[model samples]
Target: MKPIVRVVRTGTANLASVVASLRRVDAEPVLCADPALLRAADRVVLPGVGALGAAMGTLQGDLGDALRARVEAGRPTLAICLGLQLLLEGSDESPGVPALGLVPGRARRFDGDALRVPQLGWNRVEPDAGCRLLEPGYAYFAHSFYLPDAPEGWAVARTTHGVTYTSALERGPVLACQFHPELSGAWGLGLLARWLEA
Candidate 1:
């Protein structure tokens, strides 16, 4: 039987592409926002787009708590783009708002003085030695805020735009990506396939 992947309804995510990508990998993608279902899922994909505050607002209360508990328990989860940022403590984009805090640190804006903000388009992701799903390839990135460094004990993947930042971080069954894998072509699909198999 195909693995049932619960795609969280963040109210601000690119659900169409994400759902299509999961289906392409032969997994059953269920779009859900229920806290109970989220905690009980075999696999979960937390996808987000647009502003951080708005996404956080949608995730407040039981939904946010459920996601934190799921990741803390080391369940299989794939967080994409703003989803990755939501895993951190907070972001510069929205001050005084607490995030899931699954990973330490905050998301900061790319230095506009040094290079372009948002870092739109494809960029290289250099995976660390122990990465299971991420490979060295150009992934599609569309964000202004980024985690400056990798948290300890997480399998890190780095990418450079203005500065070298953690493009992806994996620990146990939880994987987070700063880029949108659903829109990232073959390399992204391969990563999704590996995650599904794992």
Candidate 2:
């Protein structure tokens, strides 16, 4: 079946970057800014950048409503970077905005209070052997904020910059990743391709 991935343009989200990445894997994707077209999509990719409060606000405003509907219908959704952060209940970055409430947890900044803030550079992402999207090697990460602990059994993968932290999360059919697979080389591209194939 041909996949129709909807790219959400909300808050500080970057849709073009996601489009470029999906195209490299031959995934036929489309930018769905309109709520009508977005709701009609088969599968959607929720990718983003920028702060949590503003990002979550945009999601909650309009895009989030459409996403919640799509997810409730059992459609496939992929959340990357800040997009993943939007799935949580709240983020310390902006508690006022309120997250999607999909996962029972809060996102926080990595200020090296235990690890390092703005974890820049290569780090190993050890998948739990159950993560089908994992490439069995290190995936590049460039973020200052991430989910510390993903509730009980939600976390699927982790990474270590200075200390071990949750890097990937899975709840139901939604797969959210904190790193940029598109910039992580062949392994990353392979992961994107795998997700598309799945």
Candidate 3:
């Protein structure tokens, strides 16, 4: 039977794209914001594409607590873009806004005027030797803030924009990506398939 993947509804933009991507991979996708569904998930996909403050606001109280518990137990979980950002301690985008803090780090804005903000295009990512799902290639990116410092050993891939930032993180059953695998065409679907298999 196909693995059940619950897409946690964090009220982020491009959520539908993620669902479609999962379906392409042949994994079952359940669009859910309910805490009970989150708690019972065998595999969970936390996808987001909007402001950090608003995202955190929607995942308040028991829903937030349940997610924490699930991650702490090392259940298979995937975080994408803003969902990945929310796993950190906090973000510079919205100062003073607390985050889930699953991965020890902070999301910082791009510095210098050398590159445009939001990075609205495809960019290459250098995966760590341990990252088997994808080889080094371009992935879709659309964000202004990035996690530059995420404790040692957490980052499984790195990409350069204005600076070398974490492109993906892997620690146990938890996986996160700064880029949108859903919008990244074939390679993206392949990556999602690998996660589902895990």
Candidate 4:
């Protein structure tokens, strides 16, 4: 059977694009809000956009607990952009707003004259030795907040906008990206294929 991927729809702006990306990989996409469906999914995708505080508010109570439990189980999981931000300890985007804390560190707004906030458009991601899934290429990025100090072992890929920042985090079955592979072109599709095949 084709893989069943559950997408967490917590009102992220780019949820549709992520679902389309999964379909491009030949995976069955299931739009999910309930924790039970998330726990039962073959793979889980947490894709988001918009304000961190609002996203957190949308995922409170049982939904948050279920997501944490799934992460703890180390199931195949993927988070993108704001979705990636939500996994951190917290974000400067909204002070005192608690995140899922699945990944260590905090998300901070981009600060530099060389580039504008939201770091729009494509940026190249340099992958680590273990990141066979991601080739050195530009991926679509559209976020201002980034995880500047991720846990030592979780960063699997790095990208530079003005300053160096994490592009991807990989630990066990959990993989998250700061860029949108769906928006990215053929290389992005190839990267998604690698993840799906794994």
lDDT of each: 0.92, 0.75, 0.85, 0.84
lDDT of 4 by residue, 1-198 (tens): 878888888975667778888888899888889888887777888888889999999889888888888878877888888888888889989998999988888988899777798799988889888765667898999999888754776647889877898888877667888898889988788877777766
Residue-wise C-alpha lDDT for candidate 3, range 1-198, written one tens digit per residue: 777799887766667798888888888898888898898889999998889999999888877887898878878889899988888899998888899887788999998878899888899988887765556888999999998854675637898997898888876667899999999998888788887766
Worst 10 residues of 3 by lDDT: 147-156
Q: Candidate 2 — which residues are off by over 4 angstroms?
A: 113-116, 153-155, 171-173
Which candidate number would show the highest TM-score if scored against the true structure? Answer: 1
Deviation from native of the Cα of residue 99 in model 2, angstroms: 0.8
Model 1, total clashes: 0
Can you write out model 2's per-residue Cα lDDT over 1-198, one digit (the tens) per residue?
Answer: 456677787748766767888887877788776777777776678887888877776666566778877665656778888877888788888868788887677887776466657887778888776666665677777777778874675638888766577788664556788898877888888877777765
Higher-TM-score candidate among 1 and 3? 1
Clashes in model 3: which pairs? none
Per-model TM values vs. the true structure: 0.97, 0.88, 0.94, 0.94
Deviation (Å) of 111 in candidate 4: 0.8
Give the per-residue lDDT digits (tens) of candidate 1, residues 27-108.
Answer: 9999999999999999999998999999999999999999999888999999999999999999999998888888998999
Model 1, 46: alpha-carbon shift in Å? Answer: 0.2
| TM-score for candidate 4, residues paired by index | 0.94
